[model samples]
Target: MRVVKAPDVRRSEILAAANQLFQTQGYSRTSVDQIVNKVRIAKGTFYHYFKSKEQILDALADQLVLDMAYHSEQIANHTQLNAIEKIVTIISEQNRLQSEQQNVVDSMHLPDNRQLHERINIKIVLTFGPILATVIEQGNQQGLFDVKDPLSTIQFILAGSLFLFGEGVFNWPPEQAQARIQSMIILIERTFGAQPGSMIIALNQCLNEEKR
Candidate 1:
């Protein structure tokens, strides 16, 4: 008798294989054949789950956003950490995730990856905004932040930063990127009514940790 996997489990296996290939081989170079071979699945089976390689990529992006939101929620709900600390923790988690997936992250900057990159950014904001907004809302209740609309504030923040780092959008030089990042820190601080330099310090620390 042959053991059978559930549809969701099989889909996840396909995605896992695709993710590993995309990481090691780069998205453009990783074909559906490679993914199906990795999973020991037939071509028809692969198509049963995903219409095309691009569909798999989109699913991967959705998975990334969901994972990020899950991690953010964990940090946001840590009872011992204050509102500011929770925000910092969430940022640190983001940096850590990016670092771990650096290769995949770098691929998103390729010229051909523009459309997928935009879709990922939109998914990230849609998924992560509410998680961050919960932290911001808690901060407001604690008098640690003053944002009038937590969800909208978080959404704007994500969109602005995404636009800055977007591959084809700004094409910012190192100096320009640094300047924009600093400005973003200031904007976030003011938006949250946090101390003038607090977010800068926290963000710098997170960046330093990412480098390690």
Candidate 2:
């Protein structure tokens, strides 16, 4: 394996540690002092790369986008699943992420949560929206989806999926959470309504959407 430079390697390690800590603990509760203490570095060294706590958080958001993009690639490459199946897989992954995040006491409960949530939404859109679009276009071309606007359909799916995540986090009665996700997915699948013998056209439209 090629060796990474010491500083870049160290920076990534530090950021990874910080991301976990800050995500699990409230941003307000996490401190650079705590980060340095866990990273086993001196406070002076922590300050050398990051001037303020806010800067580190900004970096964390950037990293989140990169991770989401990685996930999108994984969704696109599932061989046994076609476009419609991939959409279900996408939502499944989102559900898994929501479950993981629920354990974290983050700023999502605070007044400033709106700002953070919007930022996260924008990142999610940028990273995964294209993948959703490709699937929608494929479904439409194959007559599997009756949607006239593939773009708008993808947008709705993204928004709806996030809403499911919100309900899981905020709604009471675990069964309600399950019902919400199932209802949304049912809505999406009905909207798409995949049919047999359309795989060829589906693949073509998916490729065309990627070119757009």
On TM-score, the candidate that comes out on top is 1
Residue pairs of candidate 2 with colliding backbone atoms: none
lDDT of 2: 0.62
The TM-score that candidate 1 achieves is 0.89
Which parts of model 2 have CA positions greater than 4 angstroms off?
1-7, 23-28, 97-105, 141-143, 160-183, 193-212
Worst 10 residues of 1 by lDDT: 203-212
All models, RMSD in angstroms: 2.3, 8.1
Instruction: List the global CA lDDT of all models.
Output: 0.81, 0.62
Candidate 1, residues 45-89, lDDT tens digits: the string is: 989989998788778776766777889999988999888898888
Total clashes for model 1: 0
lDDT of 2 by residue, 1-212 (tens): 53344888778877877777866776788888889888888787778788877667667666555655677678867667666667656655654554454423244434555666666766676667777787677666656676667666777777665554542246436565555545554565556664433333433343223222
Q: Number of backbone collisions per candidate, in order?
A: 0, 0
